[model samples]
Target: MADKAAAQEFDILILGGGSGGYAAALRSVELGFSVGLIEKGKLGGTCLHNGCIPTKALLHSAEIAENAKTASKYGINATFDSIDMTAVNSYKDNIIAGKFRGLQGLIKSKGITVIEGEGKLTSEKTIEVNGETYTGKNIILATGSYSRSLPGLEIGGKVITSDQALKMDTVPKSAVILGGGVIGVEFASVWNSFGVDVTIVEGLPSLVPNEDAAIIKQLERAYKKRGIKFSTGIFFDNVQQNDDGVVVTLADGKKFEADLLLVAVGRGPVTANLGYEEAGLTMDRGFVITNERLHTGVGNVYAVGDIVPGLQLAHRGFQQGIFVAEEIAGLKPVVVDDANIPKVTYCEPEIASVGLTEAKAKDKLGAENVEIQEYNLAGNGKTSILGSSGLIKMVREKDGPIVGVHMIGARIGEQIGEAQLIVNWEAYPEDIASLIHAHPTQNEALGEAAMALAGKPLHG
Candidate 1:
């Protein structure tokens, strides 16, 4: 950095302008710090442009198509029509464009120095972007992540990752998704609802192997009834793709072919060749290793978002960025563990969970000291009206505070705010049951679950 030309300096220089980078910038400026945020891409990174917002928009379209198909079941006489690829793409693009513009405006309003160039960590205190050096009293690395593909497998033509799948104009007649995780299942739900014959292959035994077993069972059952085929407990050995599509071979010598194969295996950290390891920062398989407070132990540098270990979620990135900003300001923000972070899967019969899973609860507490309860959504008026069936499962220490809340049902993701509060605050079941929840709403299901867990059992 000393050998470089005269460079600009700031109180904080944040690399990457994704959820984490931009978030840190906004919060840092709020704390009266001169912040510089560097990015080579759009202001809002993957989440705004590619990952969360756009994918959810696509899923919303899929939901509308499904609802139209089943309108008659609700006594509304409506005919199911075909999905116009052009209109769908137009709608998706518009949502992203609007959000992107708003985010850019927000960043500009914060009076942040937005440097548009590819940035490399030149030293513990400086970032070099396009041959221009920017030094800072404190540095934050939040380069974000990229779609990852399995080794020996290539993405092109008929085989694609989430990036290509999002921009797909025409829905394939049939699709096979590898990895039964959040990304894979969400796309499977969307493609299946669009009338595309869909199948998911996972090496794990359950679709969302991280959730409680009961929730997983309900999801598998729902998918089965929805005519979505899935093969679990088997890993794909290889994939062969041509102009005609791709065939995936399983480790058991079984093969499945589809018009297109989507590899939703997860995202990899974008810490390669950008001088992360070269700058004395510890690296674990390309992820920047940071301490509990997001400190990199390399001078005044820190790491946040997908580049840091734990949950690779956009909101988590936002929270971590804010926390880091506050920490630098001497505010000493509380650290949020990944377990307490709310996790929502936006697929049909959407899933949401916070805090511990049942298995985890039992492991942390004594098995005999963990109490559990499930309230079926059938008892909720809103759920029945929506013709959705699932249950809210709650886990707690015996005669103690609620440790977890998990749910699977239509639009259940919306209920996670209350659930996260319950779990993160360690509220007892009775504490929630004592509160008034509005009637005739899906939210009431959570209250009812709490009631049952409190041993009141007002409704089934």
Candidate 2:
């Protein structure tokens, strides 16, 4: 397809081509809307070009190295050695570029117009890109987010954000990670596997603070066994860069030095310079506020993804994007239940959760009504065979229904599909317990946990 000149019109004009933007564009086009997607950056947005894709590529390299070293225990004798950062980075880049190309092709196949430039919402129905105005019946914002930093700390050579850390050409000898959320734990696992001295400083009481307490404890023990250190319930006092590296000062009057400092606190929405406020939209902090229907304050304007509040996962953006597209197509789509959405942290011994945590369940359903059961991975044959460590936790009301399930273990994120089904359907423990799980598979852990909650457990 050849590039078209300035003048054009679209049925739906989308600003920001990240996960949410692309999702909305494709869905809108499928709904018979002439779509135009305005992207200032790459087609795949931060996820494909930076955040999720590249980080996973780097983490996979760590997983491979660690697996090779432990191959003998899995019935194969193999010796793992050094890591070539050059080769690793090349591999990561190639993967990212390939996926981006695939995404571009998909967008083109959908017959959606792609405008390469910064997009500004001139109004609810008008968007300006590359100095050209494109009018549409409806508008969607899906700019996503960027890594954030604390007050005193800033990004430099030695001090960096996830964006910079993902592209490092050389591995640091030692590193200090300032957060213990999903990003921090994932990076800590990656660096620790690469033979770096890793220390995680978390303001919360435990790592993966949003997860179940049992899961957090399991992860803490596993990370500690792998030589990763943690300083929880503490704060960062100051960080000063020197010739060797950066000196991280804690609020407790202790100092730690590292070759690199990764600030993995969180991400801030990418709504600035997008003309959201000028378009008469309501925003909190940097996030765009939207109703359950994903409608913005501006008439005929909507927002999704990191720009909209709640979970910042890409899949969540995809759902919201599709929902708004269908809603605009006059399908009268059902509202999304935020609590039904599943969340996963892609670290080794990955954490996956859906619905309420134990504390939240108690608060919502009352302590006497809520019940929880846990199945240790140690009792599962599959986990024992793979030498994986973690547990499966289930929360339900007394004879009511299963409301939540949380898991932690190697490749356990994959199991959330089953957990989500049970939770979303509000299935009772008896319902899941009646079904048979394949023997010696990781999914059997879910069945076991459910069975235990049903008052009888075959394993653990």
Candidate 3:
């Protein structure tokens, strides 16, 4: 250690102790590089405090609520009870708290210097935090994101965002959710299960617009059956909130008045006044521009996670962090494309996919050079026993490897691991079909789809 008069020096200095930053810190230390991690708030960041972990916890609680109501169908005598937000919040908070504590311990064990306070990139290799200066050979910007709202529409009172939605103690009787993306639909499922009348407004043609068409249609069907109303292909014109409630109007002059309006539009990167642009890094609408290898092209600076303008997933950030650390160590890891990343939606009827959609595959390989096959979950014994119905669609090159896999159903997200491996490894249908799948398992549906694609259909 140098004299206290000089700034602390490190091999790698990271701003933002979120999933990505902390991950890079951990890995960098393991590679024998001294690391300095900086954070303004909690170490776990949005994914742990507000985004993935908390939202998924609420979704799980919603699942239990749904299961309780439908328990009679399974011959189980159970009385459905009301939701207690205080209790629910406690449970969710506990999960996050435990994880946060574990993360803190892990970082401490790794011996990385976790600088706790707001940090800004003063230069390519230096960061200033809380009246202190830390210089490093390399720098990483992992500043995450925040809940975004439409222009001219404020977020307060009756008009709230996911952050407020998670902390709500009293449940609203009716809620009009704006935007039908992942956040919108997931909240819809949760609120609906909690006995609230929920309606979603989406400008896209269907719910989960980025998903496969088949999955979208299946989700629409399930939402309709579940009494979750949605107005698709219509843009919201205006929203006005008062002490009583909110009135949401559409472009076509349709109005939905509800006790609250949830603006589930999306999240915007948090790279505003952290001195990124001042340091000469490329910026696009608050997102930092990075190369395929995640370098900023200005010195040894790099940016990862939500600020990089690709997928804003926690795992994606985690992997990128590891990749950046390994890259700095000269390990030269195999590049992971955004397309190969697995996407999972934790709604009532979950959706999961990896690689291309059918349209995308056909577009990439030409329609004639591609092949498609699907296996309905109705025929799967496990799905039938669970009283769920959906299907798995597989996209492939003609006489070649599987290029994509999309699925929708109860707990279908659990099947994404196998699908991701198949797509990422470019496995042929026969290769998966040749493997034995346990009977009466949800995983059997994937194997059945593979079998069909291999010209050896078995109970498809």
Candidate 4:
């Protein structure tokens, strides 16, 4: 107690109680360091509130409605004539609130002090929050990100960001999404199932430009079959809201009209006006420059998560937070492998991938050394039973190991858990193919792909 009072603060003071911040706080405390966490809003951050959790809840509702319509083929007759947005919003809010409460409990159990308000980094080892000055030996900047809007398209009323999309009281009759990235596509899947006419305008040549070219083609077909429209290789020029709806103009001089306009171009780090400039930390292209050890140019200071760029994900935040905490405790934790981090986009036919894509693999290992083996879900008994179809592509090096894995299918996001293990472990095709997979499961697609890469396939 004397030592604690003599300190007058904490060993570690972290800003932003997002996924990364909370993880840092908890891990720091567990490692025997007195920790302090400051957050302006909810504990779980954007992913739990506006981003991952709420969007997924809404997507699940869309999926339930879709499944009900197709229930007759499975020997059951069910119909969904109208969607209840009120009920959906209620369900979404309840789940989000419950999760937030759970986060608060977990933080409390770890003995980490959490403060409610924005935290401004005052110096290398101090933060100011809620009219109180907190001193610490180490400070971490984990302030995450917010949805980015176009230059000409302001977000409000009929034109909104994903935050507004999550709590919409009434379902729009039609939606025109700007930017065919993960957010746009996921919303497309959501509103389309809600009987809204959805159109995606992408500045890139293909939807999910970061994905494999083949997977993008498969998604294009699937979305088209579901009555979603795509306007790829076009940019949004303007967004104007009238009494009736919103009208959007494209770079190609085309016009699109919808009840709502969603600017899902991307997100930017929330480092603006948070005293980062006053501290004089290094920043590169709107992202804080941090070393592999998660330290900034300023001593006793570090930055993590979206603020540091490269794979803005909640799990990555957790890992970085843990790493920084362990490092500060003098435990010398193993450096995090960013490549091992998995990414998932929840839509009708979800997209999930870990490690490299075929293009990325070929660039690294040379075309001759790389090989891509694919298994179509149409050939999988489990997928057929589920009335879903897609493909799984595995990237391997010439008799080496699986370097990348990409998947597209209904509920395929769930399968990424195993796919990531194989990629991260650098397991050879023969290594996985030698093992027996349970019969009639979507996971069999992975097994079959491994077999094909091993020069023998059960189903191709």
lDDT of each: 0.92, 0.89, 0.93, 0.88
Residue lDDT tens for model 2, 339-365: 889988888878999988888899999
Clashing residue pairs, backbone N/CA/C < 3 A, model 1 = none
lDDT string for model 4 (1-460, tens) is 6665444488898898988888899888877898888888989899898888999999999999898888999998788788999999999899998998898899888888887887888888778887777788999899999999867567788888898888888989999998898999999999999999999999989999998887898999999999999998876688778998988888778999999888898999999878887898988767888888988979799898989968888899888998999988889998777877888888878888888889988898899999999888999888888899999999999989999999999889988988999998889999999877788889878989999999998754
Off by over 4 Å in 4: 1-8
Candidate 2 structure lDDT: 0.89
The sequence of per-residue lDDT tens digits that candidate 3 reaches over residues 44-160 is: 899999999999999999999988999999999998889999999999999999999999999999898888889888988889999888998999889999999999999888899
Worst 10 residues of 2 by lDDT: 1-10
lDDT of 4 at 56: 91
Q: Can you give the lDDT of residue 313 in candidate 1?
A: 97
* Global Cα RMSD, each model: 1.8, 2.0, 1.1, 1.7
Residue 397 CA displacement from its true place in model 4, Å: 1.1
Residue 202's lDDT in candidate 2: 93
Using lDDT, rank the candidates from best to worst: 3, 1, 2, 4
Per-model TM-score on C-alpha atoms: 0.98, 0.97, 0.98, 0.97
